[model samples]
Target: MSADYDLLIIGGGINGAGIARDAAGRGAKVLLVEKDDLASHTSSASTKLVHGGLRYLEHFEFRLVRESLIERERLLKIAPHIIWPLRFVLPHDKGLRPKWMLRLGLFLYDNLGGRKLLPPTRTVDLRQLPHAEILEDRLIKGFEYSDCWVEDARLVVLNAMDARERGAEIRTRTECTGLLRGDTHWTAMLHGEQGDARVTARIVINAAGPWVDGVLDNAIPGIKHQNLRLVKGSHLVFPKLYEGRHAYIFQNKDNRIVFAIPYEHDFTLVGTTDALFTGDPDKVEISSEEARYICDAINEYLSVDVTPEQAIWSYSGVRPLYEDNSGNNSTVTRDYVFELDDKDGAPPILSIFGGKITTYRKLAEHALEKIGGFEDRSWTADACLPGGDIDPARFDSFFAEKMAQYPWFDPEGVRRLLRAYGTRIDRIIGSAADAGDLGQHFGATLYEAELQYLVEEEFAASAEDVLWRRSKLGLHIDAEGQERVADWFSART
Candidate 1:
């Protein structure tokens, strides 16, 4: 007999993980399977902002913006460690959108989505201390507004962890090779290192992201499933573009926008072109033209002149946007659209299209609503995820407490740990008497205790999962350090 479930989620992105947590919390047997690590694709490759999509205002996405803005504060309240306020300086260029237009939009943005928690927009002079030193001389004035930065990958992981804690089955590196529908449930063939297995579920959520259409193809073959417009967004990480924690939103000549945000304590994250993608999603990479376009956009707004070669690292991901037949890929709706096929009271499969990281929670709620039968028993909005029980207001105070408790360890390491693990830092270090007890230091703050905790608690199986997604120690840990981590995993495997 196949293991059965109430819902079988086909992807482990933010959407799938969020849905799993929501459904599992409501007393439903849930199984979420990912062909790769959670957030390995679009979820982790975002700009990492829980913003209201300020640019969406130009496209008149007011409802989407409002919903996102409301969720922003709510998300911050629940997971303050991974989500927090970030101020964006929007410089008014000469040829781009005028000041009056910008101010009017800002007014609407400020009022929409029941703005709270984050501060309102304020005008600043470019001739001021930080702005004068950072922005180009031509940029005399700009508007600073509130948005929030998220540890994108961590958000997905936390949701999955919470779902697992709530009795949901989260299977990573497991592919649904074939999905067979029965009269009342789905027989899903899963392929993983443990070998093939079959599972049954009353409902299936096709949140396969870039492969949403492909999942549909597996269930309903012969007919092409082409509701997606794959748009490749690429980002370049340069060695710290200006100082301070404040990020900049640069307006380009092509009526698009690019962001330069402080990243990983030692780099600036930028880029995200809207080039249409048709090839394999796994093969997505930044094109030279796109790289040059990003460099030009950076140069246009900031005084810093840079080349593509200056970037130390870059990453790219394909967004599986719902095809609205829009002329421009960038102008396509970031809003999610759902397709539910429950023809003649048969088993239903709901496929999700589009959607950004900011609204994943709400998206999950709505997905459940579309699935039907679940009560108005929603509870995630007020609950905390994993170790995010710390008061959002006391993130700093909590950090200080952790620092004081671990005075024997590097303060920087403690801060990073608290930020990454929140209250669960105790799981890794509670018993450790000193830094030496944390075990073999891989590099930087990475230790054997932390590695063991990641494997046992956070579902981290590989060194890449620990170094890249779990924490960005890949940037800090030297090559020798990285090899040691790989060997550590290798020895275990």
Candidate 2:
């Protein structure tokens, strides 16, 4: 099968999906193909904070910091249900950066990008604030600041769903085997369950995260590049450690910061260690040493100790960083760069590298801007992603209403659905009128209605796609529950 489109995007991660949504909203004929489920890779495995990159302030990445800050607020408004405000308690550590320097950074972080909506950063006396009570006695002074937490994988699906709503063609589990230039167009081959198909497009975008270089090597052979680095980052999940709703930013002895945040209700998500990677992205795993390193980092600041056995789950993903030749993995620029090659007047191929979850939307807009004269103007800033319709200010009230409507649902369960589906809960729950109406419950919040919704609307092709990526129910659902769900999915599909 052959279809002509204005733009063809590779990789269905945040950047690719974001670009697809932006291009499609602008009325471009768009096709996006993902080798796996959307956000099955680094996107879903992120620490999931929509921050201005507070640490980047030390590096003086002012522009990136400001843009990310603005986007953080914008995303909160756009996806009120999935993305919401999170307060981080950064305990003071005299050994690392000094208090004055940290204070200056916070002051700048507070005023940067015409601060609005989110509360400004404030100095916290660890002795006075109840949130800091869990910290070790050595930490007395701290800073509390605002950032947004995201359902990272859901964000990708929302963008793709929104793009499809605007007429973009999204192919999941479709491998883009090759690309070839032909006069004024590029032909891309994709293999999937339906067998091989070809699509011709005016422009090809290589947003293939960790595999961008590989795509160029295989799809557009003879292209040379010396400007990308792959850095592997790993995170671990353990049983909930602290009772407070806020998160912690701990300063490790090695100069990297570790985050311990509330995750998936009963778990605390902590991570990540950054190191240069030398293997395939698909083969990357959380090594035993990485787990030990992460646990040691968390144990450094907390009164309680975390061990390897305590880590219930862990994952590793490689960041396709734009190589600046920085000596340290943590010091590399988080900003993105674009490479457009258009020799002999053929259709151009644009490749993207190095981006954070916070800056994906803007990255898409800018990537399209640099797509040269072939594409239309940008239009994603004002567009709302799927289920992002609620006004940011009203999310609390909306959540309250959901709790009131489903009085039978446990408070935790209601909040989980609201946080995951946002304004789309009505679609998931429908008019069931009670808890039983949600269909078979696999475990935790894995109701049949929601799982079916994901498969039907969000392109959930497998049980892993539903359990791990679309939702983090994999951590809550027992092995037996997972087997049952897998069996049910196989029988039905």
TM-score of each: 0.99, 0.96
- Over the stretch 409-459, how does candidate 1's per-residue lDDT look in tens digits? 898898888888899989989777798998999989999999999888888
lDDT of 2 by residue, 1-493 (tens): 3339999999999999999998888888999999988998989889988999999998899999999999998888788888889899898888788999888998999888777989988888887656555777788899989898999999999999999999999999998998988888889989988899988999999999998988888756776765678988999999999887889998887788999999877889998889889988888889888999988888877778989888889988989999999999999999999989887887889999999999999998888888755356656666677777888888779878988888877778878888777778888988877779898889886788887898888988788998889888888889999997898789885
Query: What TM-score would you give candidate 2 relative to the actual structure?
Result: 0.96
Give stretches of model 2 more than 4 Å off. 1-3, 129-133, 224-226, 374-377
The candidate that wins on TM-score is 1
Error of 1 at 388 (Å): 1.0
Off by over 4 Å in 1: 1-3
Could you give the C-alpha RMSD of every candidate to the true structure, in order shown?
1.1, 1.8
